[model samples]
Target chain A: MDLPSRIVITEEGPREGFQIEPGPITTADKIALIDALSVTGLSQIQVASFVNPKHVPGWADAELVVAGFAPRVGVSYTALWFNDSGLQRALAFRGKLTLAGFISLSASEPFALRNLNRDRAGQIEAMQNYARLHWQAGVPIAKIIVMAAFGCNFGGDVPAAKVVETVSDGLSIAREAGIEVREVSLADSMGWATPRRVAAAVGAVRDRWEDLRIALHLHDTRGQGIACAYEGLRLGVTAFDAAVAGLGGCPFAGQPGAPGNIATEELALLCEEMGIATGLDIEALIEAGRLAERIVGRRLPSAALRSGTLASLRRKVGP
Target chain B: MDLPSRIVITEEGPREGFQIEPGPITTADKIALIDALSVTGLSQIQVASFVNPKHVPGWADAELVVAGFAPRVGVSYTALWFNDSGLQRALAFRGKLTLAGFISLSASEPFALRNLNRDRAGQIEAMQNYARLHWQAGVPIAKIIVMAAFGCNFGGDVPAAKVVETVSDGLSIAREAGIEVREVSLADSMGWATPRRVAAAVGAVRDRWEDLRIALHLHDTRGQGIACAYEGLRLGVTAFDAAVAGLGGCPFAGQPGAPGNIATEELALLCEEMGIATGLDIEALIEAGRLAERIVGRRLPSAALRSGTLASLRRKVGP
Candidate 1:
């Protein structure tokens, strides 16, 4: 199948990428990375997370980072908010920030408790309450991120039925709360998804939420992230979440093992080769990788930066 | 779709894996690795190459290595022969080797000159003449590998029509020469193949040769090997060529750039998790990885070994 003509990229380096680092990043570095990413032609950037500071100290200065950036005209700066309390924090800057609320429902009771510190039902209730509060406060939830939609770390294979049910539950809550979710994203939280599984999940969600814009947030832990993205692109998913330099790993998902999410440069290369216009500057993306590496005080996991692309290799060795 | 019932893994650690290393590996260590691999339930092993000693000094003692462990029930020991001359060398040790001849036909004039020192036509003619000679000598060419079937460094995007025409040509030549070709493999010499391209190529070949058993030899240079394998598996392919600990490279293809074929342990894990049986002992495979690292005097590229599997990780970290 031919690739899509225009593919939208959502840089997750500021939010998801920094959240999984070993130590907290200073607000200045976070803002610098996001500001650099804004000029890289990304359609959207997950700028920060509004989760509890204690839970994710790396994102403690999320508000400052969001306030610091000079937002680009076409690029949307998004922040992730978890529950009613997080939504309240997001609402304080709702008119000034593009907010994205995350809700995960794939885990069973035990896994949910371990990962989210709540049962599945409790998590669902928390999302419902957040949706109601956002509606009453006139806040726009830019995207509803469905985490672990493909599979869970503790729970082996998340059934497609459960994912469909969770989307349905979220839709019902949104309808009752009188809030319209602008887009929905399916995340392969633990990187346990295959291409076929990703296709099936995306297809199921799209079938239910026909009008909701779909995005895919994939982790490359098992080296299948690009493949999964290819499949998603084939299934008409144009937006994706990627970390610059492939920095970051899930503290819970990749505790002592596991690889991380797909790198932004690698993903852009894939799209570029397939004739998909991602509008990302490969050279600039590599520079962003260097900036990320400097902040982290070590090399990131980007293979494209470490090992140049095929086109670059061809040029370096001469024709 | 459910994964196939079983996957046939052809371990190429002994020959391809060691060929590109900087230092020399002792004949004893090579033999020990082959023996260790045998118990890991590999269906077949490319034990050694019968290339000229000048070309690859590492396999200069290929004859002795084959003689050391020739008789093994149920596991085929295939040796790679480059041309009619290498086929002659292989025939001398026919009593102790299961032979397979390799012919690369995916490159245009320039790349063919640099990679195989022969153009596409010259390579095909060499294979046809070698088939005739092998038939006369009563040597069974168990497999015929067509390298660079996906894409070539100098010549990009190997046309699917070219691959089909070349395979048909080789099959005709073998039939007329009274030599039976048991299997044929298509390799991604520069690792430039995507899943879509792979599916298209494999599907085209399958359409033409319904009776021919097909295998894929893929490199992970661009991290698409596993995804390509998954696509081929969905297309009903049973056999694959892999380098244990992911050790191998094609210097002519690109330097410090050409990654090895997909790791055997990763393939086994994918098959096992998808409900396919490879009969491979994952733990034993990790042991082989350790031995490979020691032999190569560096870290092997096997992800399963570096980052332990979920089961092994749990065991290492204690429940």
Candidate 2:
């Protein structure tokens, strides 16, 4: 199937990928990787998260990394924020940078408590308040990622009805605040999604929010990340969040459990092979994978990095 | 969709699985693993290959493993053979046990020459001759695995038309030999399949041979093996070839490059989750995975085995 020329790839290696690594990565290395990624044709780069430093020490240098990178033209550098306090820090940069706010509807009570320290209704209210405050300050919220839209590591399977209800609630709040939420991306935080489940979830969301752009933030914990992306692409999802070299893992999911997000190179290869136009340089993306490995001081979880692509394999074997 | 009461699982850990491992598994360990797997609910097991021992020392114990495993009543154990000479050794045990002949059809010339030392037509003629001899001798050929039916590691894309042509050729030869072929299976040697591609291949075989019993042998190298199985199951396939604990790798595909077959427990989980019954105990299967790992002196490739199943996870967390 033919795809759009301008595919939006949001790099999540810095925030999501580094967040799950066992050892701590230096601020300098993280900044260097993000700086390198900015020029690699990515439309959006998720630089860091403003969560409690104790909770995710990997992103303790969130402010430094975001401030250090020399923002490239046409690239939207964004960060994830949860509460009003987090939103306040995000809004400090305001017009100077693009920012993304995250609010998760606790698909399950345990996940809600663990992630947001609130119930489903309480979390929605919090997100609504944050969105309103951000709009009042005249800051555009580029996107809001609804975490655990598929299933939660703590909460098992989140009902599709709940996700739709949660999204509808958020959308209503955004409308009330007079803020045009550009995109509402669903995250399979636990990587429990199957292709059929992914298709159903994306189809259901599209059915409800006809005009809103959809993006998928997938983890490869259970090895269904790419399969989910394949389903999403078939469902006409144009934007996705991926990690270079598939480096990211969910911190809550614990060690070696939550694999990195879908690798950018694998995603590109999939698109290219299917006759879809994803204007990213494949070789450069592979180089990015290796670079990610160096920054992390360990091997990245990318399959494409380990197994060269068909084109590269052919070149090596010599046709 | 409702599935049949009885499902056939062909364990390929010994022959198909071990042949791909980097180092040779000792003959004693192979025999023990095969013996352990035979007691499981597997209906058929491809114990070993009769290929040249010098080429694949891993299978040098092919004869020993077959003899060591005490035959069970409902289980049909078989070995893979690449040529008529291999077929002769396979037939030597004709009265002693049931065996299946295996051949690979190359969609490209180079792959055919490298793998089987013959082209597609030559392989077909050899298989026909083997079938003729097996028929005259009253040997029941349990199954015939058409390797590289999806695509070859060396040959790139194997066109669906070529696969259909090969199937037609096999059917004609079976008809001429006056022997009713029990089962015909396709092997995705390189794991380069997409769900849509799997569906198309299975659909083509089903459409052409209405009475044909189709099985799928897949590798998890590209992480699409399970997704491919899900599609294959949707396409009405009832039989699958899986390795215990995902213990094997494709030797030719290089280290960390070729993953093992789809894990038996993972496949069983998919079947159970989809409301299809395979009459296999998942916990018992996991035990089998551990057993395989111990014998191989390394970890298996099974995700479910490494990460506890949902049920076990719940039990561990004490829901």
Candidate 3:
């Protein structure tokens, strides 16, 4: 249970957070917020999702957002894609953005169909197609996100074997298509994972693919995200995905009451307190949360923003 | 970091939760809810706090609530005490309720004075008096809770050395008064503890006091409660205190926006998923959350109650 000395957090507020909002946030606001987050010492940020506007109206201006975004010197900006059309939209960005190709596989066929518009095999095939197209276009597929890796909304008990199998199949397809795979991001889309479950999955994958970099995209829908992240860190999976202010939820989960991704501020505080070097300016992160609250016109569920950081708390309550 | 086979979870909704609430929840409603929780495989519940009604008006009817409470066999009900008068009130219950004595302390003098109306030394002296009185009366003090064990709202950075020193001083006083100490519960009163901090404090205490049982009373204000609990578990500390539906916040923290205790239902789900036996009926616990929401006339912050537990999730998303 030895933890890593450092972890990489990827901010996903602009895309995931904004997509679940009731109304569209102005492109200017998105650009401004993303720009603000770019300097927060995060290694990467998921700026926007290149999905169909008909499906998610809030992200309709993805192109404009990506175009207007000004990346910080050391931080890489990425976007998400679901299918060929989404990939095409991302490819249109050419070398401007690092495209994070997504393949959501649920051991449950119904969930796989409803969420990914394909069964497990079909989804793997689509990923192969996705890899082939990127290869044909001479573009690199930076990462393939295995969504619902823990458990799915329609699929019960996504076994560790299934997750490993899915990742292996996706990677095998990429190898056949001659596309070099960068990493695999295991997402707890339903927020159904616990620490032990995370340990088992991450351990199994890490043991099998020793050299592959593993990342976690966890949600706090069931209040287990932070604990899961701690377990992931113990397992030495460094990259994590979080949203500012706990801002996003799965629009497809049919549960509006579900919580968003783990708050970046909270995660930063955890990392800092654990002696893990996140290099995040928590003051800047809290300010970003405040800005998000102002833009969303409501209170967010981020605890660190409301409670203040550990150092601030210590100073505030000091003698 | 081997986890225990099982952990003890103490439900504190009626006592801690009702105390912070604005309106009066009738004795009948309180009795009904406690009775319902009694059958949910919970070993213990803090039914009421014998504090002055003038301070926490919601728990004004502590005597009446205790009188009306119907405890099931094998379930131990306890009441919290601040001073001798509260102890006298708890003593009236005689064999019916286990008395839990509380002494609020802070390394910060301002916090100790403002919160407890006494400095740390004075608070320890009062605990000694409480122990002598309880022993002379032939009544056992089931547990002593060290409030603000991590950090205080007014006292910043409660060092591990300070926590150990406080506990040692309190224990020394009890021994001098010829009282036996059964357990020590650490309260993260303002919910500022991170996992490593919890590890440090719990590890220090466990190393120093190996035979004494350790428990954690955690709040989720900064969204690190479950992870702290995990760290405590890893350190071989088993017992945890949680409100049924994330129900209680510190009225003394000055910021009402701070969150409540970690939800019992959520914690149960974590333990169940981790193969750590809690013996809690999560379905019934979630029902308790619903009932709590009904009594409070608002939705609680418990994520498991909102999104459903792992079993329920698997069932709902099953073939």
Candidate 4:
């Protein structure tokens, strides 16, 4: 099958990867890492999440991290926000950062309640209000994320139709605020997605909304993350969410040891061999992974880090 | 994007997984593991490899291991042979076992010499002689394996043309021995293959040898093993080689810590989600993975084992 020649890799290692760690990472270290990633040719990097300090203490220094970002010419430093309080903080940095709005739908009612403290209907209502508030503050929402789009921790197989319906509901809110919904991301938050499910969901979204740009935010919890990304590429998804050093996991995922997102360098390895133009320097990405490992003080779960790339291996053993 | 509805999974964990460990596992442990895998509905299990005992001390008791297998009715218990001496040992167990012949082509001359004590031409000649001897001894040779088909540890970016030429030479040898070549396997021994390389090579093989039953033996060294398998399935390969508990690696691949073949349970997860029938019991395969971890005394590189499957996760967090 013909695949797109270029794909966008949105780095989440600094933000998502850092948040789930047990203790705090220094603001200086976070800034240094983001600055290092800036020169790695990524089009976008999720620098921090404007979350409640009590809920996510590791990112309590979000303001400091954001202020310290020495922006590269072409890279957009982005931040994620979950509620009104987070959105207010994101809006405070209006010109310096791109605000990322999130809306997660749990396929299982129990998961919805446990993770978000709201059922699907209540979550949708809350999201509609958030969209309106963002619009009032002059922040136009272009995309919304749908978490657990494949399957859920509390439910085995989530229906694709439910995910599409949830996206439609989010899009309706965007329409109410007079904002064009340009993108929708399907997140395997629990890493419950397989290639077939990814293809089916992406295909369903494409069929329903023709012009909308689709992206995938996959977790390696089930080992099928890379496969799902590959399937997404075949189905024409041009953007993906990944972490450096394979850091990050859902705190409410019930399993604390579940793997993080697909490692950025691992994804780049696939793109590099496929001749897909990711515009990433593999060496720099490797360095970023090393920095992540140092920041976390653990061996991160990156395959490329564990086993060096084919070229690097040859260099070591070359005649 | 039409795909085949079913695929074949060849289990190699018992032989490949066990052989690489530093110490010896009892003959009884090997037998028990193979017997457990037999019930998991695999069509083929590579039970042992007859190599130099000094080189692979793990399989030194190959004769005892082969004699003890209580055969499953439908499953073919197979053994791998490296040379004339190994072939002689395999012929002794002819009635009870299916012999698996292997010949690896290293893209780098140094790798070929260090691993096989042969250059490209010499390895081809040796493979031809082996094919003739096997045929003379009444064992029909129809399949040959080409390792480092993607890239090599000592040489990066192995030419696809070289792989095709190597396979062609092996087929010629089989034909010379009056054996109709029916199967040829491409092995990413160093785990360096990507989806596009897999597609390109499979497309080339399909274009040339239209009716050949192609197989892939992939390693997860670079973390693209599962993705490569998915691509191969899209391109119409029905057979795959996986190890139980994600075991097996090239002893000469420069990095001893590199990952082995794709985990069978992990592959089953993909197959189950894709709706491709592999006739394997996933729960049984997972149990087999746990057993492998116990035998190897380390956590095998299987995502399914670390993070339970969707079904198991749901069970844990379900209402």
lDDT of 3 by residue, B62-107 (tens): 9999999788999999988877788888889978897655544454
> What are the per-residue Cα lDDT tens digits for candidate 1 across A178-225?
777657778786776777678788888778778878888887765567
Q: Order of candidates by DockQ, top first?
A: 3, 4, 2, 1
Per-residue lDDT of candidate 2, residues A217-289 (tens digit): 8876655567678767767888988888888776666436436688887777767656667767777777878
DockQ of each: 0.24, 0.29, 0.71, 0.58
Best by DockQ: 3
Quote each prediction's TM-score.
0.86, 0.88, 0.94, 0.93
Local distance difference test, each candidate: 0.74, 0.71, 0.82, 0.82
What is residue B215's positional error in candidate 4, in angstroms?
Answer: 0.6
- Which ten residues in a row are the worst by lDDT in model 3 chain A? A99-108
Model 4 lDDT, residue B249, Cα: 71
CAPRI accuracy category, model 2: acceptable
Off by over 4 Å in 4: A24-29, A67-70, A106-110, A313-319, B24-28, B67-70, B103-110, B313-319
- List residue ranges in candidate 3 displaced over 4 A: A100-110, A317-319, B100-110, B317-319
- Model 3, B247: alpha-carbon shift in Å? 1.2
**lDDT tens per residue, model 3, A80-140:** 8766788878888866787555544454456778866787778777777777777777767
Question: Which clashing pairs does model 3 show?
Answer: A317-B156
Model 1, range B209-300, lDDT digits (tens) per residue? 88888999988776667768887787778998888877887656655734677888878767776668898888798788778888888766
